[model samples]
Target: MAPIDLNLLTALDALLAERSVTGAARRMGLSVSAMSRTLTRLRTATGDPLLVQAGRSLVPTPYAETLAERVHAVAQEARAVLGPASQAIDPLSLERTFTIRANEGFVALFAPAIITAIQQAAPHVRLRFAPKPDKAATPLRDGMIDLEIGTAGASAPEMRTQLLFRDRFVGVARRDHPLFAGPVTAERYAACAHVAASRRGAWTGPVDEGLHALGLRRRVIAIVPGFLDALAIARQSDLIALVPRSCCHRGGVATEGLQSFDLPVPTPELAICVMWHPRLDADPAHRWLRQKLMALCRMPA
Candidate 1:
């Protein structure tokens, strides 16, 4: 069977509702003769006369009557789907699950605030947090993750990102470690055993480079995949854990019997960001989610 021209549905609806070629033509801004021709085509497509003369006026046939209300509704819905999305969406009615990829430190520091804000605004929305084993764009490209929160690195040019905050590395260890007994010096800091966090399990990075510049070198006894794990190890041992300052609960690393001190060697400050694929940049719900997260992160720390 031949496919029906969907455009004819609008013409058929107008014909059924108006029951006159002249009326439909005026409503749709077409000539009366053009409307008459379109009516003929619509009748041939639907296999129905659709309208018939009744006392010098046209009226819908039984078949056309059956399609009148439903056709109008479908046409209205189609128009809405094609229209601009300038109107804001109602958060209370939003029901969606957003998956975000981030490191353990980011989740520990930001998840609570994000959850609270999402719950208070959109009760039906759910959140799934995925661990970031590495900085890769495959998940975002494949729709596995809705957003990514971490320090932005080399990424595809099409990916979208918004900076959430800045973070700096802080050296953490048991509260009374010998490093705290005196002013922290490059030589003294480099003499201690250190626990380093690297997703790739590398023992040395910019921090080691900076220390080496000062004619000092720290011994890394263990390498961990995340800052929280390094912190866990440092909490009970004499080894120093190098982690982001944001990982410190309540804006300090002193929680859980650990203490944080500024690194004697200069380390680069990191820009934390929320990243997503460009496809979702303008979606109403996605935009709302980004804004809420940004607001929470920008709060005074």
Candidate 2:
């Protein structure tokens, strides 16, 4: 079959509404001869005498009457689809669910405030927090996850990232532990047993490398997948848990009976960011969510 001309729908709608070649030409800002040609094309396309002359007036045929309303509706919808998104959105009126992929540490630190802010502004908006086991852009590119919060290491270069905050690692242990009685030094920190938090269960991290620079090493007695687990073990036993300072104080995760101290050896501060695919770059709702998260992170702790 031959391809149909979408432009003809607009002309047809004008022709049917005006019911006269001169009137349609005036309405569409075209000459009468041009409007006549358009009518001929519409007639050939529809295989019908859409307009018939009745004395000095033009009247629509049964076929034209049946198509008039449908063509007008379709034309209106097409215009809306092609037009710019200039209408303002009301958050309270918006109903949507956004999925965020992040680790437990981020959830524990920021989920409560984020959820509360979202609820207060957009009560109908729901958030789904998914587990991020590793830094992979597949979910973002494939549209499975709306946003990702974490370090951008190994992330796809095409993904857009905005730094949420800067966080430093801190040593956490149960209060009144022998390490807290006196000032913590490089050697004292290295001599203590530690719980390593690594998604891959690695026994070493930046802390170990820092200690190695001083010709010292900390014994990692256990390897855990997340910071919470490391803190859980550290709270019960004598093992020291190294976690982000924000995670320890925010959301009361490690603040109960655990004490956080600055690392004796310096490790680079981790940059936490929110990442998303370029597909959502211009989306209004997605932009709003990102703004909310960034503002929440920037709030005073």
Candidate 3:
């Protein structure tokens, strides 16, 4: 019948996460005895032994495991609700780390610009660019990654996305390759051995579908995990690499020893976007970072 103390929710989240009274105490900046007393209150309030000792380490009980994620979410929402609104953030004074998951093509083409802009505005900020092995939204949901940059895919409905740029695929090969000496026709394009860039090692793509419309198929000699690898192979061999047009510029993987041509078969343009969890929608620091990325990606190459 009594209202619960909101501070207990914060302690509950920390205790469930750490699973150790000492660790939870350190996290909450409380003495061991104080944390022990708080744990007692938690056990009584929930009618469960949230944590139990197993061997030398503490483990969460079944109920605690169920409550862990929910409690953490509640604590975050509480903090966001109570925090200062429209707090002025000085980029020069900001110190934080942001993890972004993107494909190799984006890294090679646009990462340098984004990094330079961030460093100039916030010298203390650190950026960690992670590989996009798959389209799973777990990293974003679990707060492991700050942003995801790539083509639109099946993602959580609650995720926030902003269009960064639009791009189209272009075929690339060694500068002196025979494909460049003559006009690139659908049949000529299909005759050449190609390198497919797919993180899942897929043999087919929109290009293949386009070729199929004209009753033709390209010979895919190799399947690489990313565009950069495909370009690397194309640079040294006769294999043709299909990559985004923007990724073939001076700063990208296709910069040297390679030449690009428009796809002989028409394919859909790619809409590259930056995605984030909605929880960060209102965070000033996150907003600033997103703005910087959008500006950098939209800049004239």
Candidate 4:
């Protein structure tokens, strides 16, 4: 058999993705005739009509559909392999900005350490923290955000994820609050007025469900958009703030003027993960930043 040209893989990937000769031509910067000729070569090479016309638009054959994801991954991997050499990326000399999407509580708890570490190791590099209004994958796909720190619920299947750490909800209140007068119980906890934190403005979650199971319900007097805000409200007032354990504690040190306690009812543990698009898998600097974050989160506090 004659040796196959590696360039054909690039053309085949574009053709399969676009499903149109004209589109493939535009994507690969080739003329329509050239793309059509390339498609002919692809047919002979694969021994299958990768795409077939069904109506106005072209549709992939069963075989072509199976090849789409694999081919796309291969093409992306090749590009990364051919990109700037990994040896050239020295953190101390590198100058680039990476944006991370996360909630204010995580920012308050972890950002200081992360920034300090990065500054000492890579003074020329910069970090940008973006507010995470939702776990939508568009920002990562579009390169608007480099990393996202949060749970992986409903995450895109193709995106890559790494477990950073686990957390649980803990109730907090002002120091010397009335609730501390005796042993805390489910009934007394539910009787207290609460201030809930939810980015979507929801006032109920696992805690409410747990309370319901025991024929109890807490009074939510107000709702805020973030845990940080909820903590502030709890600190100055009598309302209880249920937030992640990490947010109000660092190195076993609780936030001043606030007393933390585990909820009386059982709740699920939160598995926090750092997610990113697969396209950044082979980028050395991105990999470095990811490792740094994972290490920091794993440290005893």
**Model 2 TM-score, 2 decimals:** 0.90
lDDT of 3 by residue, 77-176 (tens): 9988887776579999999999999987788788888999999999999999998788999999999999999786657778999999988989999999
The true-structure Cα RMSD of candidate 3 reads 13.8
Supply candidate 1's per-residue lDDT for 136: 84
lDDT value, residue 34 of candidate 4: 94
lDDT of each: 0.85, 0.89, 0.90, 0.88
Among all windows of ten consecutive residues in candidate 1, which has the lowest summed lDDT?
246-255
For model 4, how does the per-residue alpha-carbon lDDT over 163-250 read when each residue is reduced to its tens digit?
9999999999988999999878999999999999988888797798889999999999999998888888898899999988887666
Q: How many pairs in model 4 have backbone atoms within 3 A of each other, for residues 3 or more apart or on separate chains, i.e. clashes?
A: 0
Model 4 error, position 233 (Å): 0.8
Of 1 and 2, which scores higher on TM-score?
2
Task: Give candidate 1 regions above 4 Å deviation.
Answer: 1-6, 29-34, 85-87, 249-254
Model 2 off-target regions past 4 Å?
Answer: 55-57, 85-87
TM-score of 3: 0.72
Residue 135's lDDT within candidate 1 is 82
lDDT of 1 by residue, 32-104 (tens): 9998899888878779888888898898888888899999998777667767865598899999999988888
TM-score, one value per model: 0.87, 0.90, 0.72, 0.71
Better of 1 and 4 by TM-score: 1
**Candidate 3: lDDT of 13?**
93
